[model samples]
Target: MYSKFLILLLLSAFCTSCGSKPETTRPVTGTITESVYASGVIKGENQYQVYSTVNGLVEKVLVSEGDLVKKGTPVIQLVGKVAMLNTENAGLAAAYSRISANGERLSELENNISLARQKMNNDASLFERQKNLWDQKIGTRLEYEQRELAYSNAVNAFETAKLRYNEALKQLRFQEQQSQKNLQILQTSAKDYIIKSESEGQVYDILKKAGEMVTPQTAIAIIGDASRFLIELQIDEYDIAKIKIGQKILVNMDSYRGTTFEAKVSRVIPYMNERSKSFTIEAVFVKAPQTLYPNLTCEANIVISHKEKALTIPRDYLLDGGYVLLQKEKKQKVSTGLMDYQRVEILGGLKGDENLIKPQ
Candidate 1:
């Protein structure tokens, strides 16, 4: 009986100790800044992947990885033997389509025109002589009439020959023009085989080496503005609505340890990434470092709002979404406002002297 009594006494003592234990803090006026976190890579302004435009062996690479180049400067050259052959063939076709005296077809037409003209002149002279004879009654009427008919037929033949000659010439000219246009197209395609920079910038990398087979889809190199840079960040969709252009950002990078950089949002890409469920954003440095390279990973905290002094409490002290633990284990409902990752603002039902317990 004495042992049972001792066990009951110990149980009661344990329950009392559990009820008496307390961890508490009073609501205080303090600052809170709401920010959205993002991760991104540092990239040069206008940075882009350069691609080859023809399928061939890379004959040469004119620029190195770090070479600064101007727009339209040649960066890579392909073998282009096929393109060159095609262009030359087109040029020859254009040149040959132009008809000249040496062309048998054209010579035939010229001969017909000359022969018809000679016949016309002869018939006209004969008709004139015959008409004069008929007028003086020295020639038969039948003979004069036949001569006039011959003259008229000869004139018609001459006119027809001239028209045929002109049409043939016109056809030849049309053919020549078509050939010339085809040659121009071929030449342009051949020129494309020599990959050129689209913008003035430094080459970040050369993906294809000399003698490597490359196609139009193959990346030849990367280039971008060497003196300027911008940040490409991916922000969570949940936080993107609050992100706006011109908002200040606090940037941190592994490359620059123990340092933070200032930046501002320059653009917000509205499209969401299907894979990451995030939106892409662009920012420019307010005071960039002395130097930066392309593709450097960085982290940023986009400032959404800030309060100078507000009724705040440690985030850990809150109980669930709408309440806090009060004295004597009573649940107190407090109206909450802006919150950071570590603290929450109490809009109502909490005061500076009232104790809010941190649940253990």
Candidate 2:
């Protein structure tokens, strides 16, 4: 009986000692760096859908997929009646000068005027000499009359030649203006025969094949420099307030396994979509990989609120808002502050050394 009594006494002492010692629990401490995580898909900085501005049958494709193209580079050629008509009209107008040459015609008119003036000068000389003789009574009236008549005929011929030269100048100017107008029309028509790139980029897709009929609004090929990447994430409405612009973020891509990337919140859109009950958030990577492709799936974490030295407790220990069983003895209500998904801030009713915790 004494041995049994001693054993009971020893066990009692051990129990008392164990109860007096501080209990081991899961540590609940304030987090210095708060974070929120989300998953989304990677996208390009700019996307383009190329289309044709003129309607025709696709004749030729100058670029294939992955080909680098410059602004205003020809992408495709359209074959149709309109293209043929433009080529024919330009040829006809360019060759129109062959039928009637204005410069040659002008030269001919000038030569005729020169001959007429020479005849007028010769006749005048004869008429002057006769007039002088008539004044001196040394020439007969019939001879003077014949010379004057000849001079009058030469003057009429010279006047007619001058009029013809002026008409030729007018015709030459009119023909030059007409030719320029026709040339402009032909140039405009030629532009419709080919589609050109509006931006410098890589051809990502070819929507139309050669010999396919297309319209002005037809999307032919997509060309864009999709090298740089960004992420578009949809955040829930309940968590929108915790997110802000310029917040630091962490990213993980499905393609890059066991590798993580960093990014920042560039924009936090204010409006929430009714269908999604979420807001769109955009982020840019800090150091993007060269192999990052567009439409790649990615996850993001946006750090929100952080605390370092404040009182905190495990989330599972609390019975309700601001309520917890202290040291397995008494229940007390307390005020709280900032909360995370794992822990809650204990603002009042608990000391740092006080035992108010539970098992993990």
TM-score winner: 1
Whole-model Cα lDDT of every candidate shown, in order: 0.92, 0.78
TM-score of 2: 0.56
Across 66-151, the per-residue lDDT of candidate 2 in tens digits comes to 78888999888888576667667766765564325556777788899999999999999999999999999987999999999999
Clash count of each predicted structure: 0, 0
Residue pairs with clashing backbones, model 2: none
Cα displacement (Å) at residue 167, model 1: 2.2
Stretches of model 2 off by over 4 angstroms after superposition: 1-47, 70-73, 98-103, 123-163, 230-260, 264-284, 295-360
**Pairs in steric clash, model 1:** none
**Model 2 lowest lDDT segment of ten:** 21-30
In terms of lDDT, model 1 sits at: 0.92
Q: Write the per-residue lDDT of candidate 1 for residues 68-182, one digit (tens) a residue.
A: 9999999999888888999999988988897763288878888999999999999999999999999999978999999999999999999999899889889998998899899
